[model samples]
Target: MDDIVRQALAKWPDVPSCTGWLLLDRRGNWRMRDEAAQAGGAAGTPIRHTALLAFINRNYEADESGQWFFQNGPQRVYVELAYTPWVVRLSADAGGALSLTDQAGGVFEPSAVYVDDEGGVLFVDRSAPPRVAVLHDHDLEVFSDHAQLADDGVSGAFFWRDGVALPLQAVRRADVAGRFGFVVSPATRA
Candidate 1:
């Protein structure tokens, strides 16, 4: 949290939270959801301003309920996620470490990995309250060695991870919201 934001929060502690006005796309891009776009059911325009992007990245964070938001100075502007809160992009370095960067440009490591029924890559770290994240579909090839389908023709409860065959937990993309304690759309009025 920024010191200026903390001061604003203390100074105006009764401000109402805002939502449905910002979005974090699957590729880790921040977007502004304007009223016109909302009326037409369009995903907002991509935020391309470098300085504004940097500011938003610095102020973004999550609450205890797992609702991620950007502290726009004092008011909390919650984000609507196209997927999970954190989007993992593989680092360009030779080591090929998985990079979990939040909507805000923060980075962290995942303690465990899982593959959903639809082949969506999942990750989590339960050490300090669980935080679930998903790998961006476009970047799946970068971490191909970490997960795969079983050789069997059936898509039953089975999968292979890191060369070890294991039973598939069979998690759905929609169920992730409740199972992982995150809201796909953190709305102040919904």
Candidate 2:
């Protein structure tokens, strides 16, 4: 178990309601396999909290290649790599103007942000030129909702080839930091 994961588990013991958690190892393959273990009250059946905590304390081992796991219950999520700025920070001024900042130092004053039902952040830039975006890894980016506003609006649905942006009509549904969200760019791309 990583120090952050440990701290999260300790802080939020309720478990089910927690949305996000991270595990990092020297190796790239980190997986969390959550199984039912058993159904109903068996002879030594442990509840969700007890079983999860036990697994975290004991089975939280990393291999020589730096692979780690964070099994919750029935969700086996795998993380192949790691990066900084795992969480994004958004601030709004008294006038309702918003500014976004991530760990990568991306500061974007986007026109608006649409938070989807799945709890993802979609920043729409209608004022900026479509030819350039500040996000580094556009391929793994996702959109909060699939609603199309106008041609001038730039959706977070572009992929990268050789560090260049390629627009994709499909909306993204995963969390990819290096590319999608705003970070400080040395200069404007457009």
Candidate 3:
């Protein structure tokens, strides 16, 4: 959290949280969702302004309940996740290292990897407050070069270059929330 945001929160102390106005798309785009977009099932407009994107990314965070939100100075604006709270993108400049891009476009190092039955890849960052993110399907091919389907024919494992094979679960996509301890969408703070 930013010091300025903390000061604002301390000063105002009662601004209602905003919801469904911001979205993080599967492609790592920060979208600005309006009432029309929310009603019409639109994915919101992609945020293009560099300064605004950086501001949003800087204030993005999650609660104890795993609901992700961005601190709009004092007000908490919960993010509508298009996929997962974090979206993993390949960092070409880092020699194709797996970069975990959160809903706000911030990056983190992944400490663990998981693959579901549907070939969905999830990563865990063992930070102070651990976070789990999904690898975007568009980048699966890039990850595939370093992974393989295990002989079970139902699951796969990440073949780390260090010669370590981390086994992953084979769960249905719908079961991901329970298996991962997160809500896909929150009706209220959860």
Candidate 4:
């Protein structure tokens, strides 16, 4: 959390949280939803401001109930997630070593890899509460290159650069939020 935001919270501790106003899309874009957009169930306009994006990323956090939000100074701006709480991009070093980086620019080392029925890849880090990050769609090809399917076809293994093959488990799209302990839409919860 930012020091300025902490000061703001101390100064005004009773600020009501805002929901249905901000969204984090599947592709890792921060969106600002207006009244019309919220009413119509639209994705809203993408926020392209670099500084604002950085600020939001820096202060992003999750509540005990698994609701993700951006601590905007005093008020908490709840985030509506299109998929998982985090979106990760896959990259390879010069020696063909794979690394994962989240939308917030934080480097993630996944403890497990999962593949949904729809073929979407997800990575889970070994945090206390655990964080599930879906691989960005654009990097699917790169991910496929490092994966090997088992004889059953449903299971597989992901070969990391260090020669460690992480077992790929199967998951259902509908069970993602519940299994990972995150809320997809905070507006509905609110």
Candidate 1 residues lying further than 4 Å off, grouped into runs, are 95-103, 152-169
lDDT of 3 at 110: 63
Cα displacement (Å) at residue 180, model 4: 0.7
TM-score of each: 0.81, 0.23, 0.84, 0.95
* 1-190 per-residue lDDT for model 1 (tens digits): 7798899999998888998899888777888999997788678999999988988888877887888998987789999988887776644346543355554555655566667657787767544776777777876766555445556412333223233343334577778888888888885932
Better of 1 and 3 by TM-score: 3
TM-score winner between 3 and 4, please give it: 4
**For each predicted model, how many residue pairs clash, with residues at least 3 apart or on different chains?**
0, 8, 0, 0
Q: Model 3, range 115-182, lDDT digits (tens) per residue?
A: 66666778777676667788878877777776677687446666553466666556666776666666
Model 4: lDDT to the true structure: 0.91
Can you tell me which runs of candidate 2 are displaced by over 4 Å?
1-86, 109-117, 124-190
Quote the lDDT for 113 in model 2: 42
* Residue-level lDDT tens digits of model 2 in 1-190: 4455556666765544221233321121222323321132112222346544455534333222333333443322232223312223444456534344432234544444433333344444443331112222321122212233335343443321233332433233343332343221111111
Estimate, for each residue in 53-123, the C-alpha lDDT of model 4 and write its tens digit.
99999999999899999999999999999999999999887878898999999988888999998888999
Ranking by TM-score: 4, 3, 1, 2
The lDDT leader among the candidates is 4
